[model samples]
Target: MARLLALLGSINIGGNRVKMADLKAAFADEGFGDVQTVAASGNAILSDDREPVFIETQLERILADRFGFKSCVMVRTRDEVARAVADNPFHGEGPQHGSDKMVHSIFLSQQPQQSAFDDLLELHKSKGSERLALGTRVLYLDYVYRVGVSDLSNKFLERKLGVKGTARNMNSLKNILSKMDAE
Candidate 1:
């Protein structure tokens, strides 16, 4: 079975409160092995034989039926997770600087067109210190400030790029990667 990472949005926040134990239980009951949540951040690392797309769909259904809210669950292979970290423009270890806590890896539900990506960049050119970079099925963001108060938000990105996404900061991602590796 391939170990997959499911980045879920709005868990323990936005009124979609869900205990990690409950969430893990739901996934485990659905036959997902090694069902583990990464630091209560709505990130689930599990072993499953289903295809990534199928796993994403199944996770969405499980969340809705069992947890009572809809979420865009980005299920990626372990390699994809590594690529996301390696390819990120703001890993805080490179010239493209950003706070590890402020830098985010946004897992896109669908690939955004180059035109849309361009448009987004153009629109937000003067937004703030937040930097942006496009990745394979991912959008990297260096918030450069508090995300809650930033003009660049998930909703804004979704509208501009025409795809839903979920984000995890650089630190969280590294921790998630470490756990995935150990498994």
Candidate 2:
């Protein structure tokens, strides 16, 4: 069985709450084993023999039906997550003016168009101190100063990319990978 990481959107925020137990149950009902939630923000790891895209679509449907709400799910394999961590452009760079938690990876449900990527780059250029890098389907952000407040916020990313996604801080991503390994 292949290990998969599911990045679920529109959950556990803004009054839309689903317990980790219920989330795990949903995956288990779908025939996934070793199902676990990395954090309260809809990050889950599971092992399955199906394709990642199929898993994502099925999970989205299951979540919508089960919770009476729509969720955009993005599924990635173990190696994919590893590669994303390895390819972080800010890894070797010196510490930012703020905490490491300021670094974030926005996992996109689908790869954004080149034009969208260009648009984001343009926005980054206008906003000094904030850096942006594009990965396989992830966008890395290094916010030097504004950790909680910035124009390059999660909503800004979704609007700029024209795709559904979930943002995880660098620390959160590392923890998710560690949990995946333990399972």
Candidate 3:
């Protein structure tokens, strides 16, 4: 079995609460061991017999079938998470400020094309309050204002780029990587 981290999109963001305990139970029922949820935000670490992609697909299907909605899921191996953290371009003083909340790291399903970066930059230019730094499989965003009020939240990025992704705070990102490292 492989240890994998799965980030499940909001299944209950609007009120249909899918408790973390229920999610862990679901995974356990599916034969996944060591199932643990990091936070109420749908981060889960588990050991599974299948490949990551299969696990993601099956999990998605199960969620939809059980919960009656489709939610995006991003799965990455422990090594991938560590590499993404290390490869972050704005790791210096820039993200340490209070505005760091505006700083986001987006995990993509695959490496975006070169043209995608240019297109993304154009989109950021329109926002006028965000700076974007592209990585191999992540996009680093720094906003001039708070994240919720900023024009560069994950919804904006997804809309502009037409890509499926999820955003995580820097501290959460580091914590997830640390968990993987400890294992």
Candidate 4:
């Protein structure tokens, strides 16, 4: 069995609420083992014998069939999760816990096209303070200034790339990795 992290897109937002317990039960019913949820924002860690792509598709189908909603989920293996953390571009800028700088990753279900990449790079050119880097299946966003006012937010990425995704803070990413390690 391989451990994977499923980052659900747009769950519990805009009245599309999904209970973590229900999500866990859904995965368990599908025969996944050591299932765990990090926060209510739809982060789940589970072990399955199936491939990551298969599991991702099955999870999306199950949510639609059983839960009555279609959710775009991005599934990443344990190694991929670790790499996302390790390959961060803004790790050594300042204190990680509490500081003016923070890294947020937009976990995308599908890799954005070249046009989308160009748009992101073009946006970064105008906004030098905001640093954006492309990962294997994630987008690393380094917010050096006001996070609340930055244009490099999750919504911004979605609109620019035209892909469904969910953003996780550095702490949340670390916590998920810790949970995966524990499993």
The candidate that achieves the highest lDDT relative to the unseen native structure: 1
List model 3 lDDT by residue over 2-84, tens digit each: 78998887755876479889888987887788987887887889887677888889888878876677888888888877766
Candidate 3's TM-score reads: 0.87
TM-score of 1: 0.95
Compare the candidates by TM-score and give the number of the best one: 1
Ranking by lDDT: 1, 2, 4, 3
Q: Which wins on lDDT, candidate 2 or candidate 4?
A: 2
Reference-based TM-score of each model: 0.95, 0.90, 0.87, 0.86
What's the true lDDT of residue 151 in model 4?
71
lDDT of each residue in 10-119, candidate 2, tens digit only: 78877668999998998899899989887788998999999888998899888888887888888988888877777878754526543557677778888899899998
Model 2 TM-score is: 0.90
Worst 10 residues of 1 by lDDT: 90-99
Name the weakest run of 10 consecutive residues (lDDT summed) in model 3.
Answer: 92-101
Return the clash pairs for model 4, or none. Answer: none
Off by over 4 Å in 2: 92-99
Alpha-carbon deviation at 142 in model 4, angstroms: 1.5
Candidate 3: clashing pairs of residues = none
| Comparing 3 and 4 on lDDT, the stronger one | 4
Q: RMSD in angstroms, all models? A: 1.9, 2.0, 2.2, 2.5
